[model samples]
Target: MPRYGFIAIDDRGREYRAVDEAMSEAALEGRLRKAGHWVAKAWEIRPMLQKGGLFGGSIRVPTRPLTEFFLQLSMQLKAGIPVLTALSGEAGESPHPGLKRVVQDLSERVQSGQTLSEAMAAHPKAFPRVVVNLTKAGEASGNLAETCNRIRLYMEWQERIMADMRQALTYPAFVLVCALAFVFIVFTLLIPRFAKLLAELNVPLPLLTQIMMRTSDFFVHNWAGVLGGVAATWAGLHFGTRLSPGFALLVDRAKLKIPVIGGLWCMIGMARFAQNLGVMYGAGIALPEALGMVAGLTGNRVLEKSITELRQAVTEGRQMHSVMGSHPIFSKLVSQMIAVGETTGSLATALENVSDYYNEVLPRQIKRMFSLLEPLMIVGLVGFVGMVALSIFLPIVSLLNIR
Candidate 1:
C-alpha cells in the first residue's frame, strides 16, 4: 500500500491534514470519505526521514514492566468492567510517576468515550505501536480481555529476555568500568607520586617508565578534554539519529557488526519482531498490517528497512517466504518456518514458535557469552596493570644493581 499525505475537509468544511495508508490515491480518498472527511488534496510524501529520534534518553523508562497491571486489566475487562475503570485500577497501582500519570489521563479519556486504543495512541511516547495495534484489534474483534492477556504475556517475555541479556553484559561491563577507574588512579595518583620520588633521587627512568609518565601527565593535564570528547560523541550520535536517517542506518548497521555483542543484539531484535508479529497475527491482523506494526518493534534501521521492503513485496502479491528469503539477515530456519506457515495457513503459530524458540535460547546464550567475557576482561586488565608496575620497578632494580 502507498502512504499519502492528505489535506481534507468534513461535510461542514472543517479542514484537517494527516498522513495515511492506502493502496492508491483513489483508495485513500475513499477511506477519508468513509471516515467522514471530504478530500480536498492528496499527495505522497517521500519517506526520506523514516524514524523518530533516540527514544527518551539514557535512562530507559520501562514502558511495559508492570506484569500485574496487564493481568488485572485482562481480568477486569473479562468481567465486563468498563475500560475506564480498568485503566483507573491500573493507574492506582502503578508506582512509576510517569506511567501512573499517563494511566490516569488515559482512564479519563476512556471515560469520555474514546476507545482504549484511541486513548493509548495519545501517549505515543509511553505505548509502542504494537501495543496500540493489539488494543485496536482486540476492540475490533470484541476480545479485549484476551488481547490484554496476550500483550501482557508478550511484554513479560520481552522484559525477561532483556533482563537476561543485561545480566550477560553485567560482569564485563562492571569489569571494564573498574579497569578504567584503576587506570585513572594509576595515572592521577600513584604514577605522579612515584615520579616525584624518582625526580628527587635524580634516577634515570627506563624508556617504558618515561612513556608511562608522559602519558599520565598528558591525561592529568587534559582530563576536561577527555570528558568533553565523551559528551560530544554522545550528543553527535543523538542528534545524528534525529537529523539524518542515513547516519542512523549506518549506526544500526555498525551495531550488527559488533563482535560477540552484535550477534546477541540481532537475536534480541529478531525475537521482538517475531513475538509482536505473532501477537498481531493471532489477534486477526492481516499479514501486511502485521508487518507494518512489527517494523516499529525492531530498534535497528537496517532491519526496519528490510521489513518495509518485505511489506511492499507482500502488497504486490509476492510470496512471504520468497520476499524474506531475499534478505540475508534472516536465517534459513526462520524463512523455512514462514514458508511452512504460509502453506499451512499457520503463520501465527509459526511466528509464535519462533518467539518461543528464541525466548528459550537467547538467555542461555547471553549467559555463556558473559561468562566468557568476564575472565577475558579480568586477565587483560591485570596484564595491563602488571606491565605498568613492572615498567616502573624494573628501572629501580637496575639502579640498585649499579650501586
Candidate 2:
C-alpha cells in the first residue's frame, strides 16, 4: 500500500500531521474530509533504507532496547497519543542507532496508514513472531496497549530463563576449559619430556607409562584434527536441522530423552508451549488456529509434533487434553490443568498456570544440575590428575629400585 504523509486542519482550525494510505490524493482528501478535516499538506514517503539499519536489511535490535520500545509504545498508546506520534517519539527516545532508524521507518509507515503490527511485521528480527501475532490480536480486540505490556513481560521471562541457563553452565564450562588446557600442557609438553628421558634410560616402561606416551603422542600430532572434527560435527548437526526435517526431528527427540538434562529440556519446551498457547488462545484466536501459532515455538521437534497432534484433535472435535495422554512430553499436571480449563472454557488461563508451574520449576532444575555437576567435575579433575601423576611417577620408582 502506498502511504502519504499529510498535514490536516480540523473544524477547530487546529493542524495535525498524520499518515494515511490511499490510492491517490483525491481518495485521501475524501476520507479526511469525512472526519471534518481539511487537507493542508501531503507527500508520499518512499523509504530508501527500508526495515533495517545502515549495516543491512536485517537489523538485530537488542532485547533491552526492544523491550523499552514495546513498553514506551504501550504507555504512549494508553495515554491516548496517536500511533504515529508515539512512534515518532520512540524514534527519538531510543539510544540504539538501529532501533532509532527502525522506529523512524515505523512511524513513517504508520503515518502512511499501515497498522502498527503491519509495520512490525516488516522487521521480523527486530519484532518477534509472538509479538507480531499478539499485536495483531490486540489490534483486533482493541487491547493493543495491554497486549504490548504482556509481550514485554513474556520477553522478560524468556530473557531470565536464558540468563539462568547461561549462569548455570558458566562454572561447568570454566572447569572443562581449565581441565582441557591442563591436560594439553601435560600431554604435549610435560609428558613428551618425561617420555624422552625414560627412552634415553633404555629401561622397561610400565604399562601405564606406555599408554601415557602413546596418548600424549596422539594429542601432540592430532590436536588440530580433533578440533577440526569437532567443528565439522557441530556444523553438520546445525545445518542438518535446517536442511532436513527428519534428521532434525530425530535429533530433537534424542535431546528430549537425555537422562537428566532431557527432562529439563522438555520442561523448558513445555513452559514455552503453554505460555505462547495461552497468549494466542486468550487473544480470541480459535483453538486450532492458536495451536498453529505455537507450532514451532517449542524448540523441540517432539513437542512440536505434539502441538500438531493437539491441533488435529481440536479440529476433529476431540478434547486436546485427551490426546495429551498419548504424548509423554506433556506432564500429568499440564494435562489436568488444560483439561479443567477446557471444561471451564478458560483454556487460556489453564495454559498460563501450566506455564507458571514450569517457569518456577526450570530455575530450580538448573540450580540442582549445577550443584550436582560441581562435585562430578571435581572428582573427574582429581581422577585425571591422579592418573597423570601415576603415569610419570610409576616408571621413576621402578628405575630407582633397579639401581
Candidate 3:
C-alpha cells in the first residue's frame, strides 16, 4: 500500500491535510469522497519514518487482558462459529471499555465486507504488528483460530517480561528521586547557613569546603539556565529525530553501545523478533514476509538493519542459521538452535522455542538486576547524604570552638 498526503475540503469548505494509505490515486480519491471530503491536492508519501512519543504517542492504549479474548475467539472459531458473530459477541461482553469499543468498531468494519486483517490494521494502536500479520496469514491459510491461540500464548509471555522489567526499573527510579531531593535540600538550606557562619567567623576555609561552596554558588546562580538547557536539549533531540531518520538511526546505534541496559535491550528486541517471526511462519507465512514484518516490529533501527540483511540472505537462499550467526547481537546458542531447526525442517518451532527460552530467562535476569540495584541504591544514598552531612557538621564544630 502507498501512502498519499492529501489536501481536501470538507462539506463546510474547511481545508484539512491528511496522510492515508491506499492502493492507488483513484482509491485514495474514493476514500476521501466517502469520508465527505473533496480532494483538492494529493501527493504520495515516499518514505515513512519510525517515530514514537514519550507516552507511546498514538500507539499507547489502555491495559487490556487479551488472553480471554484470544481464548474465546479461538474456541468459538474452532467450534465452527463465524468470525463476525464471535467479534460481535465479544464486543458486547468485553470487560475493558477501550477494548470493547475497539471490538465494536472492528466488528462493524468486518461485517461491512472488510477482511478481518483489514479491520485490525485500522486499529494500529490496539492490535500490534504481530497480531495483524498473524491474522492476515491465518486468514490466507484457513487456520485463524490456531494462530490466535499461538499469539495469545506469546502475548502472555511478553506481558510477564514487561512486568518484570518495570519492577526492575522502579526501585532505581525511586532512589534517584530521593538522591536528587537530598542534594537539593543540602544546597538550598544547609549550605547557605554554613556559608553565613563561616563568613561570621572570618576564617580561611579548607580546599574541600571551598570547592563545595563554589559548586553550590554556581548551581544557585545558574539553576534556571541549567534547567532550561536540559529542557532544550531534550526537546531538540525529540524533535530532531522526528524530522530525520538518519538522526534516529544514529541514536539507535548509540543506544546499543550502552552497557548492561543495552545488552538487555538487544536481547529483548531479538526475542520479540523471533517470537513474531515464529508466529508468522507457524501460520504458514513465507519466510521473506515474516522477516519483513519482524524488522518493522523490532523498533530498533540497528536491529531492523540486521533483520533486513537476514531477509536478504534468505531471499538469496542463504541458510538462516548461518545468517544469524554472522550477527554479534545474536547468541551462539540461538544460532545453533536455528541450525538444528533448519536441518530438521522445524524452523518455526525452533524460533518459538528460542523466544520461550528468552521469555523464561528474562524475568530471572530482571530479578537479579533489581536485587543488585536495591542495595547499590541504598549504599549510594547513604554515602552521598553522609558526605553532605559531614560537610555541614564539620564547619559548625569549628565555629563553636571559636565561640
Candidate 4:
C-alpha cells in the first residue's frame, strides 16, 4: 500500500489534508469521493520518479487544442448532443494528434457507460485534475455545458497572460545572450589581437589597458575552464532546487525580493491566484477546496505555502481577508477587495475583480519593465565595446609617443 497525500473538502466546506494508505491513486480519489469529499489534489506521498518543470512532466495536450476541444464540447452538449456523440466527433476533428488520441480514448470510455468526468479522470496527464474537477462540478450542477464554456474562457485568459510574458521576455533574453557572446568574442579574439599588437609595440600600458589585456590573456588560456565552471554552476543551481524543497522555497523567496522584476512577479502570481480561485468558486466549489486547487498554480512556492495555510485557516472558520492581510506578500488591493467581498458575500466576484485589476496592471508593468531593461542592456553593450576600443587605443597612443 502506497501512502498518498490528499487535500479535500467535506460537504460542510471544511478542508483536510492527511496521509492515507491506498492501493492506487484512483482508489484514493474514489474512496474520498465515496465519503463525500471533494478532492482538490491527491498523489502518492513519494513518487517513484520525480518529475518537475516542462520537460520532466508527463505528456500533456497543448493549451490551444485543449481549449478548442472544450469549446466544441461545450457547444455540442448545449445543442443536446450526447456525450458519446460529442466526444466521438471531437476525437476525429481535434487538430492536435495528442489530443485526438486522448479524445478517442475518452469516447471509448464514455461508450462503455462511464460518466464523462470519470472517463476523463483515467487520463490525468491529458485532462488535468482541474479539468476533471470542474467537469464533475458541472455534472453535479447539471450544467456541464456552461462549466465547460467557462473552463475554455479561463484557459484562454491564462494562456494569453503566459504568451504576453513570453513575448516580453523573449527579446530581452535574446539580446542578453547575444551580448554575452560578443563579450566572449572580445575576450578571446578581438582583445587578444590588440594585446599582441601592443606587446610587439613594447610600450607602457595604461592601468585600464593593462587590466583588460590581462583579462583577455587569462580567458584565452583558460577558456575551457571558464566555460566548464559556468556550465557546472548552472546545472547545480537548476537541479538543486528540484532536489530540495527547502532550497527551492528559499529561491522562490529570493525571486520575490529581486528589484523591479520581483514586484511584477508578485502581481502575476496574485492575478493567477485570484482568477483560479474565482473560477473554481464560481463553478460551485467551496473556497477551501478551490484554494486547494489554486495553491500550486501561483508559480511561486512561497505564495503556494501562504495559500495552503490560508486554506487551512479558512477551513478552521477564520476570515480569509484577515489571513491575507497578515501576509505581507499579499497586496493591500487584494486584501481590501477580499474584505469587501466577504462582507457583501460576493467573494467570487471580488476575486474576479482582483484578477481583472491585475490583468490591466500587468501590461503596464511589463511595458515599464521593458523600458528599463532595454536601456540598461543597450548601455551595457555600448560600455563593453567602448572599454575595449579605449583599452586598445590608449596603448597605441602611448606606443606612438614613445617612438
Candidate 5:
C-alpha cells in the first residue's frame, strides 16, 4: 500500500499531521474521517532515498525505551486509562524520537477507530510479531493490560540476556585484539629488522628464524590480499545467510555445535522459546499458535525447524510432548516436564519453569566459559610471543658465537 501524508482536524479541534498507508487518497480521507478527524488535505508520500540498501532506512530505538513503553502502557491501562489516552500520554512524554513518532502514529490510528493491535501492526520495528499477536489475543480476551505486562517482562529478560552475553565476550575480545596487535608489530616491525641483521651477518639461519622471516615477508608483501580475503569472506557469509535459507540453516546448526559457546547459544535459544511460549500461552493464545510464535523466537533455524514440526504435529491433533520428545533439541527433563504440564493442563507454568532454569544456567555457563577462555588466551599469547622472541634471539646468539 502507498503511504500518504495528511493534515486532519480531530473531534477535539486539534490538527494532526502524519504519514499513514492507505490504498488511495479517498481511503486515507475515509480512514481519518472514521477516526473522527476531518481531512484538511492529503497527498501521496514518495519514499525518501535510504542510505543503505535494505538495512539503513530506519533509526534503531533501543530496547529499554520500548520495554519502558510497554510497562507504562500496561500500568496506565491497568489504572483504567483509555487506550488512546495512554498512547497519547506515552507519545507526549517519550524522550526517544523514534518511539515517540511510533506512539504518536499508534495514537492517531487508535483515535481513528483502529484497535491497539492494528495500530501496532503498522510499526513492526517497535512492535514485534509476538507482541502484536499477544496484544491481539489480549484485545480479543479483553485483557490487554496483562498482555502488555507480559511483553514488558519478556523484553526485560531479553535485554538482560543480551547484556550478559556482551559482557562475557568483552574481555576475550579485548585480549584477542591485543594479541593481534602484538603479532602485527612482531611481524611487520621486529622480524624485518632481525631479517636485515641476519642478512648482514651472512650466517645460516635456524629453521625457526627462517620460518618466522618467511611468514613476516608474506604478510609484509601481501597484506592487501590478506585484508581483501577477510573482507570477501565476511561479505560472502553475510550475503549467503540473507540469500539462502538452506545455507543459513546450516550455519545455525553449526552454531549449536561450536566448541565452548555452542551450549550457551542452545540454552539461550531454548530459554527464549520457552519464555515466549509461556507468555503467549498465559495470554490465552492457542498452543499451536504459541508454538508457531516460539519457533520464530528461537533465532536458530535448527530449533525453528523442530518447533515448526512440533506445531504441525499439534495441528494434526498429535500429542505435543510426544513430538517434542522425539526431537533431540529438547532435553529429556524438558520433555518430561512438558508431558506433566500437558497432563495437568498447566503447560504455561511448566514452560515458565523451563525458561527460568535456562535463564539461571546461562549466566553461570557464560561466566565459567569466559573464565577458562581468559586463561587459555593469556597462555597462548605469552607462548606465541615467547616463541617469536626465541626465534629472533637464538639466531643472534649463534651468529655471535660464530664471530
Candidate 6:
C-alpha cells in the first residue's frame, strides 16, 4: 500500500490534512468522503533519504523515556484531556529530541484526522507492532487510556529486566577485560625482557617458565593473525545470525542451555511473553492475533517458532494450553495454570500470574548467579596473576641462589 497526503474539509467545516495509506488517490479520497470529509486534494507521498547529522546518524530515543512519555500520556487521558492536548504537551516538554520529533509528528497526524494508532504505526522504530495493535484495540474498545497504561507498564518491566541483566554481567565483563589486558601486556612487553635476561644468565629454565616464554613469543610474532582471526569469527557469527534462520534458531536454542545465564534467559522470555499476552488478551484482542503479536516480543527464534505453532493451533480451534504444553518453553506449572485458566474462563489473569511469578523469581536467580560469579572471577584472576609472577621470578631466584 502507498501513502497519500490529503487535504479535506470535515462535516464541521474544519480543514484537515494527513498522510494515509491506500491503494490509490481515488481510494484515499473515497475514505475521506466516507468519514464525512470533502477531499480537496490528494497526492502520493514518496519516502526521502534523510542525511546524517554531525552526530553521524539519527538520534534514537531510548525505551525508558518512551515508557515515561506513555505513563504521562495515559494519566492525561485518564484525566479527560484530549489526545491532541496530551500529545502536544508531551512533545513540548520532552527532553529527548528524537521523542519530541515523533510526538510532534503524531500530534500533526492526529490533528489531520488520523487515528492515534495509525499515526503511531508510521514510526515503527519508536512504537512497535505490539503497541500499535494494542492502541488499535483500545481505539476499537474505547479504552485508549488503559491501553497506554499497559504499554507503559510493559516497557518499564522490560527495561528493568534488561537493566538487571546488564548490571549482573558488569563485574564479570570488567574482570575479563582486565585479565585480557594483563595477558597482552605480559606477552608483548614484559615477557620478552625477562626472556632476554634469562638467556644472558645461561641457566636451565623450568618447564613452566619455558612453556610461558614460548607461548609469549608465539603471540608476539603472530598478534596480527590472532586479531584477524577474532575479527573474522565475530563477523561470521554476526552475519550468520542475520542471514540464516536455521543457524539463528540453533544459536538461540543453545543460549538457553548455557549454565547460569540460560535459566535467566528463559525466565526473561517467559515473563515478557506472559505480560504481553495478558495485556492484549485483557484488552479484548483475539487469542490467535494476540499470540501472533506476542511472538515477536520473545526475541528468541526457538520460542517464536513455538508461539507461531501455538497461534496456528488456536486458529484451528485447538485448546491453547494443550498445544502449549507440548513445547518445552512453557514449564509444567505454566501449562497447568493456563489449562486451569482456560477451563475457568480467566486466561488473562492466569497469564498475569505467570508473569508475576517470573518477575519475582528472576531477580533472585540473577542475584544468586552474581554471588557465585564474583568469587569465581576473583579466584581466576588471582591464579592467573600468580602463575605469571611465578614464571617470571622463579628463574631470577634460581640465578641468585647460584651466585
Best by lDDT: 5
lDDT of 4: 0.84
Clashing pairs for model 2 are: 19-111
Between candidates 2 and 3, which one is better according to lDDT?
2
Task: Write the number of the candidate with greater lDDT, choosing between 2 and 5.
Answer: 5
Report how far off residue 75 is in candidate 2 (Å): 2.0
Model 2 weakest 10-residue run by lDDT:
46-55
TM-score of each: 0.80, 0.88, 0.81, 0.83, 0.87, 0.86
Count of clashing residue pairs in every prediction: 0, 1, 0, 0, 1, 0
lDDT of each: 0.81, 0.85, 0.79, 0.84, 0.86, 0.85
Task: State the lDDT of candidate 4 residue by residue for 201-287, as single tens digits.
Answer: 678889999899899889989989998999999898799889998988999999999998898888888888988887788888889
Which digits, one per residue and each the tens of the lDDT, describe model 3 over residues 142-235?
9999988887887776777778888778978898898899888777777877888789878667666777788888888889998999999999
lDDT of candidate 6 over 262-362, digit per residue (tens) = 88788778877888899899887999999999998888888899999999999999998999878988889889989999999888888889888888888
TM-score of candidate 2 to 2 decimals? 0.88
Off by over 4 Å in 3: 1-63, 397-403
- Where in model 1 is the C-alpha error above 4 Å? 1-66, 82-104
Alpha-carbon runs more than 4 Å astray in model 6: 1-7, 10-59, 400-403
Clashing pairs in 1: none
lDDT of 2 at 173: 92
1-403: candidate 1 lDDT, tens digit per residue: 4556667888788876566778888998987789788988776532321123234311123735446667888999999997877787888888777667667656655554468887677666666778888989999999989999998998888778777767777778889999999999999998988888888888878889998899889889999998999999999999999899999999999999999988877887888788888889898788898998788778888888999899999989998889888998788889999899989987888888888887778788788878888899989998989978897887799779778
Error of 2 at 338 (Å): 0.6
Q: How well does candidate 5 score on lDDT at residue 133?
A: 96
Candidate of highest TM-score: 2
Taking the tens digit of each residue's C-alpha lDDT, what string does model 2 give over 1-403? 6667888899899987777689888899999899899998887654444544334554668888888888898898899987788888888889999899778878776765678888888787788887888899989999888888888877888888989999999999999999988998999999999999999998789898899999999989999998999999999999999999999999998997788888888888888888888777776667898888798898988889989988998899999999998887778888899899989987778888887887888899988988898889989999999999999889989999999
Off by over 4 Å in 5: 1-59
What count of clashes does model 4 give?
0
Error in Å for residue 394 of model 4: 0.5
By TM-score, the candidates rank as: 2, 5, 6, 4, 3, 1
Off by over 4 Å in 2: 1-56
